[model samples]
Target: MNKGLLFSCLLVAVTSVQAAPISIPYQGFFQRLKQVNKGNYPLVEIAFSVPNKSKCLIKSGTITTETESFPLTITQDQRIFLPYDARLKSDRALVNLDIKGSADNCNISMQVRAKNTKQSYSQKELLELQAEMNTMLSDMQGFPMRYFSQDIEGINFEFESGSQTSVKIDGQRQVFTDKLRLSQEQLNKLSVVEFDTKPLVISPWTHG
Candidate 1:
């Protein structure tokens, strides 16, 4: 969904909460503890959390999970609530975003695993993209700058936010934690919620 569309959706979600009567569940300590590994930073991984009482039906295909589950909606008011809390952590599903940061700063690159039908961005393409990225971030940080040095003889660069799946745009890799900091308008424009939970390692992925 584009930024505009997402903003609209959020508006609608908020409206729904306000119009209806909702209640938060009183789950025990174990219940609350179950939501710990939501693939995001900060133990509670809810981006925009909406909890509920007893239970509710989740439409088919709304998520990729094989089974259906419900924890609760945390709001009783009319405002749309993204899961910023942990009470319903176990009940929520995730949309991961991966990111990496350079010590020098001035660039934001995302790691896109596949493009069209190809498996990884090529080395030659990366250089060109790197040049373009420098241009994009230059204006953001003020004054011109260069990459932090490709001294990757063994410089394992790894930093991740939510699930660790990053998007490779213009040869850069960015995580959800980074993206979340974007303006709500910017986030609404994003659509590729990468399911990247690989922990942003320098090497390949392995199941946690």
Candidate 2:
């Protein structure tokens, strides 16, 4: 599938849920971008608030490149992961979230450093990403897949629930809402979520 066409398809899908809250966690974007480039699966955690009250579940979806469309597998825990192909330029990659369930509106954000990152991309960062994509050598240019790393991480647009109801970043209480664009101040002060998934625990044992 043509990546352009695929993005178009996914963009259309985005519109259907445009009214819902969707955002990219700008603070930890660099780390997530690294993961994407390295072909690692970047997990997206979506939270929902139901004015009408409905449950949502994402079963499966596809990630497309110019030549191929990869399958995105969903775990029972509601984490969405994908085998991102390094050969493809993902700067403009679109994620078509296949959501099941209901709600008055769905809140979407990216999980960066185990904290929900707002989906707003910084203008400068966006420009830089575009430049990188423009400079990246493609498979068509005789570059091998491995050499064509630096996969662009796609912004997440869909989620369920978590223990952490809300978070504070940069000394500001951050709560995600249904909004497409964000301001410069918000982008500049975007918080880097500091939650750790695992912490070491000690058990007493006697050693001679």
Candidate 3:
């Protein structure tokens, strides 16, 4: 092959590899555990994300403390469930991800989520959870953005399928579905959030 052609081919190959996704190590304060330790939220989840075209799959993973290691499996949706563990609450933990296939094409990132317990929450408790979630969001934002950006505009709560869960915000009862979005306006007026059934997950929600 001509020297010029060979150089061009090499450049293209390098570019392709460089463009591939890479796994991201977890960082920031483990606020999910703090929320779980509060005892209101019983479940926490570490959710992973990968590009649709990426070949990165998490075969297995572990959350290890100084003395103990807990084996965990990622679900099809790329989620690892971590139920509230009193031991892990105070102990510092390290998360290790085991990626399947080539590391080059696999780009995995994670976000922590807090899940509601089976018991319904009263207005006071719901407001407390919302406040805690906002705090957690702030911690995750970090640095300049954390200082400049306003708190999350809304709250998105996900409920189990086929379950009838409802929340009354400011005396206005809203039924829950797969996803429920409470806008900033609604949240400002939120004095009462009464849930009939607990939600599966709670997250920050911003309108499109």
Candidate 4:
């Protein structure tokens, strides 16, 4: 069992469920990137854990980078929200971040216009995405056979002619094809994803 646990994405999905509203789990650390559109739809990518079976809802969270800042909010109903145009105007957009605290901590950085085009997931769909990514990553890089580690290394993607490497920030193997202007529909059968040249990565813990 290489993936005994799935931290971030699964937490978001489970929390969204009416029966499974998320509660902060530990005083540890976690990281995730979330996307929310004006429609209130959310897409999540995480490298950490939520308060497993605890009693806190992610009303909102944010991350700051050298050039930008990205904040995420989850409504009581668990709708993820990110205001991008608002972030672009800010001094620092999140380049990378990590969460560490006695409270629930999850790091997230918004990319590709947090609102440009968000894809929401049904419970089944969200689980499918996580399963798909995990399976693929195991094939490409060979994940650990016994357990999953909180710190996922070498999960970034580099474009052929691009100078920057876009870390898939989320530990899963799937990529964002539509965001890359690639053919998402045409590759319906393939599990591979492409990253935008403008990229982000997973860092360590931030006390906040």
Candidate 5:
């Protein structure tokens, strides 16, 4: 979604939580541990939130797999999410987003996997949607963020509340512990819930 559209949606669904200065290299979405090694997992999807009142040029970008890395095509002022797939081993991968005219470079390491579910719902189902996620999270304790890095998902529902939680499930049936840290205003304008659990690795700009 475009920044204007997303901001409009946020305004329509205004909450008590106020906005704060969040850094870039934001991981809007990524793979969850339990589903990473699954047969259908996606390679990667990259997204970011630019600083308010400021924009940066995407000087260069690249995705590095186990033993190889390739350049990515990104345009100036392109802020929406993009999908990336090297089709190499996805057990571990690295992404680098070098912003022009800025010192901060966004780097991320994550597991890529196909999504387990993707669905849409009406605005009336917002409460139900959250409730369902809470239930699933309760069963698994909570989902985990990337190790040695920031949250793989940029949107922190509990940043202000500071009651963040994370959990991971392994294929070997092992449970691992990890830690880390949305909105409505414009609900009326929203036509669908747009739920996607598939962790797609987005390429900056591609025609396919």
Candidate 6:
């Protein structure tokens, strides 16, 4: 099948789950895997979020390829990290999700992430990440829609417990323990960001 067609099929399958199992195509999975590999990330996660108002629960799941089957472990937060397997790059596979109730009641997404809780990043890398994140946010809230939408306020770096890190904002060294927030303007003005211990995760921070 054409790659585009396969992707379209996968989208349709994910969006219209009804009472049946969700089937993700090999092509889609491979594309995400390739992204992780290219970035040198340890794992890619498939996350399912069930709305608080919804009663649906995921019962079980498995990933099956042409040559192997692996049982999936769904976390308490309803996320499953795809196991890294070099063989998956060359094989056809499908991820099957079984829901106890209605699959349509849940939201599914995929994210690439680093494995380590602490890792160093250069100033150049931080700037690059800021630019990429800003571009993504702009694209998401572009043109007419941005006028009414409440976009994220800034980027936040979440550190592991008891970890301390520091970054220079406008020539002043600011230290943080649990979390650090950097505005887009601050990120642009940043010259040196020093970390005693690297952050565990970097995410968008939205105002409440």
Evaluated with TM-score, which candidate comes out highest? 6
Per-residue CA lDDT of model 2 for 56-93, tens digit only, reads: 55545555544655565655644455333333334433
The collision pairs in model 3 are none
lDDT of each: 0.26, 0.32, 0.50, 0.31, 0.30, 0.53
Best candidate per lDDT, number? 6
| Global lDDT of model 3 | 0.50
lDDT of 1 by residue, 164-204 (tens): 44554334467545222222233234432222342222211
**lDDT at 121 for candidate 4?**
21
lDDT of 5 by residue, 1-208 (tens): 2221211122111122222211222122233223322332132221333332143445566655557666655434333333433243243454455554433322222211112323334555533443333232232222332112111222112111223233221111222222111243333345443422221221111011
Task: List ranges where model 3 is wrong by over 4 Å.
Answer: 1-57, 62-70, 73-77, 81-107, 140-147, 160-177, 188-197
Instruction: Give the TM-score comparing model 1 with the true structure, all chains together.
Output: 0.18
How far does residue 185 in candidate 1 sit from its true spot (Å)? 36
Candidate no. 2 TM-score: 0.30
Stretches > 4 Å off in candidate 1: 1-118, 143-208
Model 2, total clashes: 9
Model 6: colliding residue pairs: none
Model 6 lDDT per residue over 7-89, tens place: 11222224665755676765555554444345422222222233322445667778888778888887655655566665665
lDDT of 1 at 46: 14
- Over 4 Å off, model 4: 6-49, 52-54, 73-134, 137-208
User: How do the candidates rank by lDDT, highest first?
Assistant: 6, 3, 2, 4, 5, 1
Residue 71 CA displacement from its true place in model 5, Å: 5.3
Give lDDT tens digits, candidate 4, residues 1-208. 2232332223322222232222332111222221212122233232332332134345345555455445555443333443334433344343221222323333222221121212222334423433344433333222212343322221222133335333232334344431232222322334433344432321111011
User: Which stretches of candidate 6 lie above 4 Å from their native place?
Assistant: 1-13, 40-56, 84-86, 112-154, 157-181, 187-201, 204-208
- True-vs-predicted CA distance for residue 189, candidate 3, Å: 3.7
